[model samples]
Target: MTTLDPYLAARIHLLSGLDWDGIADPEARSRFDEYGRDPGEWTMPDVDVVDHAAPGPHGDVTVRVYTPPAPAAGALLWVHGGGFWGGDLDMPESSVVAAELASRAGIVVASVGYRLAVDGVRYPVPLDDVVAAWEWFVRERPAASPVCLGGASAGGALALAAAIRLRDAGSLLPAGLFLAYPVVHFPVPALDDATAAAMRSLPPLLRFPPSLIEEMFANYVGRLGDLPPLATPGHAPLGGLPAVHLVSCELDDLRPSADLLARQLAEAGVEVRAQLAAGMPHGHLNRTPTLDGVDRSLAHFAAGLRALNGAGEVPPDVA
Candidate 1:
């Protein structure tokens, strides 16, 4: 079996002995706050970043757009993941990924700041914000440019649901989809024996057990039963969607969910190109881009973006 990346394994090893569930809230927050601090250096390629307000049903949704100096290969509407409640435009998964994709793939990226599932906000609220941002981005971009939709973790669920919505509504659809370690299932499918064994070595904080999965969904949709299909899109019909590039992390509990969705997509006749990020954990994109795994994941997504516009491949330097 492949081992965890040494850097990540060392980090996880430090927390392996901690009783994550037993820790007091305040203490746990204090101990883990360092993980969220911005990396001191930001040595990414030069790109023009701007934020714009896109009209949504509830209010204006903010979209951070990144533009490359060169002509763009295509446009991507990107979403960040936080279990549907925690991420923002400033997170590395949002800003760093957008900047890298724009500069490396020569693509314009619109990172959506969707409403989180908190303070009574629930299903369809975050989805609506994403849809609104997508429509606005589509209208703003050149008609000839190919546009793709992408997200990581919960954001993947939103991106796929939005794609399905656009298809059913007879609206313009994206040219492709780029999903990274997406948690698209309700129960989050059971892991295979190999994956289960691999997960045993991870810290409690790194794991997503069944109970945690249920709690996350409960917080997301209020009630799990009689839910809208889009709430857990893995069960929804995935036919007629555009080409998909799915990245499943090797050691993630949610890897099974991504695997299930890949099968569903293929059975539904969608073109799917899936890769397992070896020796990686879920949300590795949240790490500093200097990490080898993070750069590899970014390159995989950038290559997919370039392919969406028939741009051949990512440049060697970018790759």
Candidate 2:
């Protein structure tokens, strides 16, 4: 058996005792707040964040815009990675990602807060919010300029789904797509295996059951068999889609699905690039200090954006 990494084990131990179900909405928000409360400290010298609220189909969706040091020629609409049930607009890990992307790409980065599954908002609701946020950015934030869409995990899935919806409806396509270890399919064969094992080896809270995945999907999708290509982007067509960069972790359950989509995109003649992060876990990007995978991932995204926006040249660090 593989020995659990010590840091991962410690994280698991901390999470195990926490009662996620019993926590009130305000408490959960407080916990999320604790993770990334100080945006000023979180911001790098090259990064500046603008907090804005835009109208959505449901209501106003909040977006945190990240501006890099250089002139902003284009923008990336970033979605945070929470398995649909949890996560907020200002989580530290995501904030760090937004800052890094803005700094590296010299582009405007808009981190979005779509409706979460926990508050009766589910599937298409999140998708609607994503689209609404994208449209709002294009209409309101002229400084953001030419736009692209991207996200991690569930956010990644939503990014692709939103792009597809936009393309199908004849909306302007983003310059490119960026996804990091995205969770694309529900009732997957076994995504939580490594995550579950990580929990068992580390402590207790870190170890979650595969069953919970089912519960989350059911709640979001409203039924077991009601799956649509939009919800599971792997099953969707890719012809005429914008250039895409999909990053997946070696130990992540979403690896296989990402692989399948990569193959499909290639077969359809779409410009697509996918990187598999060896030895990383499902949410590895969030733990940036613990993992260097996102470094390479963001550098690649920077290069891609530069190329897409005619922003001059790709950075030397990108492979």
Clashes (backbone N, CA, C under 3 Å), per candidate, total: 0, 3
Q: lDDT per residue, candidate 2, 89-142, as tens digits?
A: 666447877888787777888899888887667789899999999998888656
Write the residue-wise lDDT of candidate 1 on 65-149 in tens digits.
9998875658999999999989999998999999998987898999999999999999999999999999999999887779999
Q: Highest lDDT among the candidates is held by which one?
A: 1
Give the distance in Å from residue 29's predicted Cα in candidate 1 to where it truly belongs.
5.6
Task: Point out where model 1 deviates above 4 Å.
Answer: 19-42, 314-319
After superposition, the stretches of candidate 2 with alpha carbons farther than 4 Å from their true spots are: 1-43, 141-145, 189-209, 311-319
Compute the lDDT of residue 71 as modeled in candidate 2. Answer: 48
**Model 2 reaches what TM-score against the true structure?**
0.80
Candidate 2: which pairs clash? 9-202, 16-205, 199-207
CA lDDT of each prediction against the hidden true structure: 0.86, 0.71
